[model samples]
Target chain A: MRTGTGAGMPQRGAVGAEERIRAAAVRLWSERGFHGVGIRELAEEAGLSSATLYHYMGTKEDLLADVMSRGLRRLVLAAERVTQQRAGAGPRMNALVQLHVLTHALRPRETRVVDGELRALSGDRRGGVMSLRDEYERYWRATIDEGRASGAFRVEAPGMARLALLEMCTGVARWYDPGGPMALSEVALGHAQLASRVLGAEELELVDEVDWCRGLVGEIWSGPGGG
Target chain B: MRTGTGAGMPQRGAVGAEERIRAAAVRLWSERGFHGVGIRELAEEAGLSSATLYHYMGTKEDLLADVMSRGLRRLVLAAERVTQQRAGAGPRMNALVQLHVLTHALRPRETRVVDGELRALSGDRRGGVMSLRDEYERYWRATIDEGRASGAFRVEAPGMARLALLEMCTGVARWYDPGGPMALSEVALGHAQLASRVLGAEELELVDEVDWCRGLVGEIWSGPGGG
Candidate 1:
């Protein structure tokens, strides 16, 4: 998963140049579309020369694909971990919603890039990113399917319900502000409850799940895995 | 509120040049953010010279603002017409969802610009567009409030519920395809039912309202009002 390291750059290998490059790419690409940015601009933003940029990454499209892949793959990992222990559909859905809302709230720029830039990639790159996204979405689909099977939830169109719920949670990225009046915990809990309503499931007390998901977001995003 | 009309362009004034310019702006701006596009490219896309582009519209920001205002204003008009005769909260909410889903599905490019470009404008222009958007959102807010007061809807937080529902409905623009398996009517009704679930209200048979709203979308978007 890591690339563009020289023998002399070992000290910075853990968390310096490549991280800066990823950060710069996410910021610029999110501000402007993929075609709207240039390699030199990315290099300057990352405080590297153009030659060094190419040394670290492939083409600009490659960089975009890398950013999207990393983000979606991180989501896949987090969703897997969150739902691994939860057996009941209601609690599973609640935990998933809280995790998603918190992720979108904390990592809005990355979420915007992943959501908005899928059409910008070429065929193979697009397919790869799309597959990762689909993989992530399956967690939601399976939760709904399990809920329907056990008669824990009642939805006319499970597919449409999943889509609606995903968009609703992902939208926290577009507008959530840390400095806003609503506490992050409140937002996560509110969305979890909303998810229950959307699924026509009984409301469970998800305060603990919300707090647990917050810790999980901190771990995944702060570690070398995602951020 | 058109700015680019001149004295000598009566024949093209009604529906030819201005419509082309609006269409081109929506397409380009939706593809690229406001800062990502250039005046030269916009003029080329509109099939007009740069000078003529200036004559037809103000600055680039002005054009963006105009496009947003037109799209949002059309929603305001349509929402008012749809909700005016309906007294119950369920019926009103159902109609609003259908209209919004249809508008976003049919005019995705315009919806993208309106939803995505609010940050690109300066103070006065941003304030104007924001006012139109807030005005449009008030319809949803009032409907939700009415539902809560009348005991027709049950929700923990009306504001959060409103935000979630709005995002869910607006998401139709991101992925809907007319040529896809789900007909437009199914998409609209599906969303209407989902909205009902979110509000904890009984599902209303909104098939008739969905059909009527489709006709309303045709009239508003196809006429000089929105398109």
Candidate 2:
């Protein structure tokens, strides 16, 4: 996952210098938070000079905004793709869960960056990212509402229900360890069950139950595989 | 509520300097996070000098710890009082909701500071505060578990049920307004209904509803009448 080159660079086994810089920035920001980190330290950590760091990404605030915007854009795109692929409210909701879980599994740093640093983005930048977030929230809101209206979901207050579901999902990033216990697929399915139950899913077939159990068992047995 | 004056103070109507400092710290911390605000600015905001600020509160970190510890201690005390005042899981849970809602409504800045700045504390200070918080969470967790065990609540997982309930109560701090259309009592009642329902409470009597609503209404309607 860390082997890819930067946007303009040719493909190689090692990430291009620009990509390396961005990756380093993500790591530092996640650990120290947005305001606590400095550009000089980030540059040194990335094994680059301050001038070279600017060549890759602009100011510290610009890097923060870019990190958040890029991550949110990917999430929105994934959600959009899921919405496109799945047909009904139930499947679409499931797809949404899968996309969220997969994205968190693959890019936990990016997810944390977006979640923790939105306040650091000021004015139009903050508003713009927040609008994107609202759109993503709408996906869940619409699914919950549509499911309720269609008699598929039994929960009251679609808005509150959406909040509950999203919080549960977003919380995954806080505790999820890709190398620990359950595979991403398994974790997603378990979360899907939790979400579906909250949304009033009536029953789980043996196969679904088996799949969920297998995932849990795999997670417990593996004892934290490679992230 | 702001009329407290320490002994030897000349002004009778003025709030004590210590209380004033805590209030200012809460406001500043909530607006700008723990690491973002400076003691000098906090002093100025509180209409005092840095020297005076030191007289009341030792250091910036000390102020942060004091603010968080005081708020958390109040919540713990409130929950303890509520538990002692009410019998049975149902009543106790109602009391818990009232305490939580009231604490959040009356002291939103403090609540925000505690919730948002826990990660910034270290060693004994952080551990002490966290232990208190955990104990507070346990009160709700125990109520939910008891309710479920006695067939009073119908949630599958007591921990998740507790989290859901706490999230709803804590969310009041995010959107609550004194001049909103619904009185605090009305909003608290609505939240109580939502919390009780999530906890599998069946009855919806007006008294229980009002008991649930007391904190929010008390916070708003009793603004001039009380704190």
Candidate 3:
């Protein structure tokens, strides 16, 4: 999972200030990477004094973990919602791919932070992020397994298929542009179709619904519960 | 084409010493990223004095361009070889996917530098890398187009499918471990099958010869032209 469906946010208290700091951290960290940026520069980017930054975000590594975990939490929540839908495995997988694509396209910076900075964290911090990542992927694994069990898919390698689909969906963050010719909804739908074909369920018809996934992304990344 | 099959290498002389330096550059750059590493540190890691580093590898950015171009050149060569085979679109595509999987799985660090550090290059250097990458993917685009023309594929979105498949194959670098239980050849064959299915060609026979691809990778990466 290159874009492992997570980033960060302020925990509680001083909510506005913390969110501002986090937003800046995601932007800089994604741009320069976790080890490349300095604390002072992060503070400057967030318009906070260095002393104030330490108080608000703690150490840089802590801030990184927070950003990655928060981003991942949103992804996990979206996956859970899709899995719990009344739709069966095929539609559920469609929604899952669409949701992952939309989130990555709309929130590339945060996703990059989550995808590229795992090495910067130490033991417990890394473990926590990995745990969250595992939970998010579990939704994907279960969905694929269900589809396979029902003979809805013909994938020869389920584990490889899950990873391939994830990387395919996440690549949107690297290449998709809001200002580009492709519409966001179109990108999501196209990816869903590609995913269905990859999973050998093109005959089953992907329960294509970009509008639903779009709404979910809007709620997660920009919604009150998101950041 | 985020992992568009390229990195860097030495342009002028210093043959053996230069290859060693570039090898170390790939390791350090892939591990710590371009910005996170310094010339002095690169020199130390390469077992060369700072002065000798410049003599062998030129500037750091120049070194990066060389590494990327060299890597891309190898991929382009492999892609060319596959495309030239008498096999039709299905086999060519399978071989391309298998070759990609093998290269990324066997040479994860080099591929990571190729995939992750595009922003590290500048101006003409970036353009040089991009041109090489474009040339490499032209093979893939051509193969997909050929499949569609022959009624061998059912892909609805050709451009998106190419990107999706490339990202999916490139993902072998991110998750594959040589120490893992899955055999290397199994990974390659599974990806080829997944690719064939994704391109809507599951009913068509994929020219699944990972052994052939394995041989090509050996010749390309360790061949006389590669180093």
Candidate 4:
């Protein structure tokens, strides 16, 4: 499930010291499961001391919830924009799928942590994380239900279709590679079409807003109060 | 992501010692992940000492490989059966979707280890594990390609469709719960229809062989030379 090699998945090279720690945390946490990663290794990966690591992020659980929250929050904002930017429900749904595929492909580690490690959070921490997740999923459910009501999409079980399409689109995080022949745009288009088909649409629509989505992801993920 | 609690997931209440070890491995490995699990806890769960654990399954890697291989082999056999059970490629693909969803639902731990820990294997072990996976996926690819050739499944990219459908069906493993309101039968049927839609089929066909698939899975996983 690990993507980058021993060099530790390069950063922007302009990230601040604290941001570097956050990035390293996401990378190491994804490459090695949370329990498999240690404080010293994390500090080493971040080029900082364990004490300084605590300065930037509280506990490991605090850092984990921070990562998960940031990823889900950005997704929610992106989902809100994509579902509203386009005029019709069908087009909004199409845009949502394309944007989701692109974001997941771009931030595989962050998305993977969000998808795979919710069980690790507990108590109020778990509640906060799950609430953000619920907020993110609400956009998807609302769009699907709107499409179904508008006669833009047909599905016997809208909830099932939502789960299926979300899982289908989120899978881009698992195998997407920029070095490979498959481009991020191609993945977005393909997953959008698949999502359409999954929802029982008679015809598929392609959305071309990759740059917009990329900018939005950057703004949301790195913006103030993101993590 | 954890399945059951305390009672250790309630196996048939009667199984051989080796089977008990296998069950324990799946539960622990799924909850804590492979690296997070240790032999002592595994042995304790199986009601045996570490010596007996090593006796039954050689090394930890051997046991990991055994667990992964058993899941994949059973899937491949079930894929073979389901793909050949019906005459047309459509029904075959439908059955494959249902069987996959059902199997993943019933045995999330096995499927999780198989999907998430492929990189944990190295050298000949990795090769052997991936070969079984390729064999399993070949049935999916062949069925999809056959459907495309026969004009039964409409798809722009058959490979993408195959990946999408497989991931969609397999997502059941991450979320399906026996105590939840969504019945296993409903999940099977819903995913079958969703698979048909993802492949761009105009009509959804129901597959009636769920029990047969369940039986075949038990037989294959329990059969000799399987694990």
TM-score of each: 0.92, 0.74, 0.90, 0.87
State the DockQ, from 0 to 1, for candidate 4: 0.63
Name the lDDT of candidate 3.
Answer: 0.84
Off by over 4 Å in 1: A1-15, A203-207, A225-227, B1-16, B203-207, B225-227
In terms of lDDT, the poorest run of 10 residues in model 2 chain B is: B218-227
List the TM values for chain B, per candidate: 0.90, 0.81, 0.90, 0.85
TM-score of 2: 0.74
What is the fraction of true interface contacts found in candidate 3? Answer: 0.58
Q: Give the CAPRI class of candidate 4.
A: medium
Could you give the DockQ of candidate 1? 0.67
> Which structure is stronger by TM-score: 1 or 4?
1
Model 4, residue A16: C-alpha shift (Å): 5.3
Question: Candidate 4 chain A, which ten residues in sequence have the lowest lDDT sum?
Answer: A1-10
Which candidate gets the maximum DockQ versus the true structure?
A: 1
* Ranking of all predicted structures according to TM-score, beginning with the best and ending with the worst: 1, 3, 4, 2
Q: How is the predicted docking of candidate 3 categorized under the CAPRI scheme?
A: medium
What is the CA-based DockQ of model 2? 0.23
TM-score of chain A of each: 0.90, 0.78, 0.90, 0.86
For model 1, which pairs clash? B4-B56
Q: Which stretches of candidate 2 lie over 4 Å from their true place?
A: A1-21, A38-56, A94-109, A172-194, A200-227, B1-15, B47-55, B98-102, B171-227
* Angstrom error at residue A144, model 2: 1.4
* C-alpha lDDT values of all predictions: 0.84, 0.67, 0.84, 0.80
